[model samples]
Target: MPVQKENVSTAISSDGGSGVSSDRLQAVARGDNIPAEVHKSVFETTPVLKINAFNLWYGTKQVIHNISMPIPRNQITALVGPSGCGKSTLLRSVNRMNDLIQNVHIAGDMQLNGDSIYDSRMDVIDLRKRMGMVFQKPNPFPMSIFENVVYALRIDGEKNRSVLEEVCEISLRGAALWDEVKDCLNDSALKLSGGQQQRLCIARAVAAEPEVLLLDEPCSALDPIATGKIEDLIQELRGQYSVLMVTHNMQQASRTSDYTAFLYLGRLIEYGPTSDIFTNPVLRETESYVTGRFG
Candidate 1:
């Protein structure tokens, strides 16, 4: 069954201030198919990211329908769907990576900490600084391991060697790669194994002290051992930073995420706690997808 959408606009409170008016979001999502309202219990903490009546298109082709959801702070939320279902597209939108693509158009409201990211006064660089992203493959620069982790800080103009070194160690340790690479900080990052390189990417993302981390299939290209290590790292990351991950692996979603959102054909089909979404879904389409009956 399809999700329902009522035309009534809604308002929310964040950090003791008013949030975006639903009227604005309604206009942003004009003519798009909005998903049903998510249950309040699905979110257990103050949301770090709120997406309301959001839609996206490339030229004239719509790729994301009206999506309204809240990503809880300090928890892992996974977006799961089949290929080309807009999972990656939606993830990229969090940090505005999609803007680099030609002919991209977007509407509706995306808020981080109750501030509208798309507002005219918002700074794109600062927005991305608050959110870290790790791509599907580990594309480390041809630099030393230490430099890779502190790249973001350097770009932001941090010149203190002590501060950079401290951040590098802490971030690498947080990503569970410090012990393995601490002795060889000056070695080329590309010389590490695929799993180590991916972990390095995670360390790099966190060096800037972002509030959220976005992973686009961070373990897709690795073997079982590497995948297991990454999964463990994700588990450790819980309660420290809000994480949003896009994964095709259903089992990985169940293993690592506290919440899950299901999408199909550019529309959100179902979303809730990870346990409920996997064992008991309210929608037949979600049940079919989880049970291996259909995608």
Candidate 2:
């Protein structure tokens, strides 16, 4: 059975938890200077990406506040929050996607595998090449399935047909789509169904052998069955790639992620093991949000 929100509250209340005080919760709601309640276990795992006091602003309005968190290597870390809470903004910051926008300024820094992402001499293209990103919707290229999967290699000047073919099969298999599309390798990727297209996109992302996978609501646009498949695929990728995902689905976050970070008003609230965050979060605000009480 699906874990219910009341069950989570009950589990916490049974331990004599009094929950967050109204004054503290009011302070958080007022955007007061409250330090993030990051769990120490967040630092116990080896981090593939380190976000240090990161902040962002669009024109004059600030969106992301001072936030610091480590994305553990080879594990799924989920960013969960209500709408307009800067989850996607923070995710985009990791790969400098926010750089595309005009008048967007940032403070602080993020390090990918110990290399500074905001360095003046950093190659944005090269930096992006180290990570693969999938958007909310499936975006299969206007090309054949084989081409779509091997597009990364092709652009990098890979000309060996045997090598491209090998990577294509391996990537598709890795995404659990090879068995479905093996016979139709030359077919246009657009001809596939929504789920297949999303899986094809995953295959394309993995084809590059990126150090990290960035998924922004990867399953939101799909049906229940498709969502399940994507969730399963994400779990299967746990040991092979470090995944940083932004998802609004509380259930999905609890189901697929090892660590969960709760973001509110662009500030990191609480981050810890998924089980603890759902069952015993240190803040009442977090519990209220996780349960069906509020966004």
Global lDDT scores for all candidate models: 0.86, 0.91
In candidate 2, what residue range of length 10 has the lowest lDDT sum? Answer: 2-11
1-295 per-residue lDDT for model 2 (tens digits): 4322221222234467754334444666787988888888888899999999999999999999999999999999999998999999999999999999999999999999999999999999999999999999999999999999999999999999999999999999999999999999999999999999999999999999999999999999999999999999999999999999999999999999999999988999889899989998877678878985667
User: Per-residue error at 167 for model 1, in Å?
Assistant: 1.0
Q: In candidate 2, residue 285 scores what lDDT?
A: 73
Q: Model 2: residues >4 Å from true position, as ranges?
A: 1-22
Q: What is the lDDT of residue 227 in candidate 1?
A: 98
| lDDT tens digits by residue: candidate 1, 209-236 | 8888999999999999999999999999
Count of clashes, each model: 0, 0
Sequence-dependent TM-score of model 1: 0.87
